[model samples]
Target: MDESYFVGWGTLMLINAVLAQGKNRSGLNWFLLSLLLGPVATFFLALSEKK
Candidate 1:
């Protein structure tokens, strides 16, 4: 359980870092949202980027 939690959080942080590398506004928004919302929010933000 603990390992899985760490892996999940680590993955989310990696994805958030990638997402936060381009535009300043979106990057800041994603970084803040990732902290507040976690993996599910990361998934949602990634999906929303497609549209």
Candidate 2:
């Protein structure tokens, strides 16, 4: 259960990175941010306008 939790978190980080890139933002920066913010990062990315 703990292992799956980590896997899911890691996956979310990568997805957030890609999503940020789609918004013309920095992927690596968002990846690191998502490591701390998780789903909140997804919400921010979702609401952000594409540059």
**lDDT top scorer:** 2
Worst 10 residues of 1 by lDDT: 20-29
Per residue, candidate 1 scores C-alpha lDDT tens digits across 1-51 of 679987877678667866756423366567667776887777776665432
After superposing candidate 1, which stretches have Cα over 4 Å from the reference?
1-11, 20-25
List ranges where model 2 is wrong by over 4 Å.
none
What number of clashing residue pairs does each candidate have, in the order they appear? Answer: 0, 0
Residue 34 lDDT (model 2): 96
lDDT of each: 0.67, 0.96
Cα lDDT of candidate 1 equals 0.67
Residue pairs with colliding backbones in model 2 are none
Candidate 2 contains a number of clashing pairs equal to 0
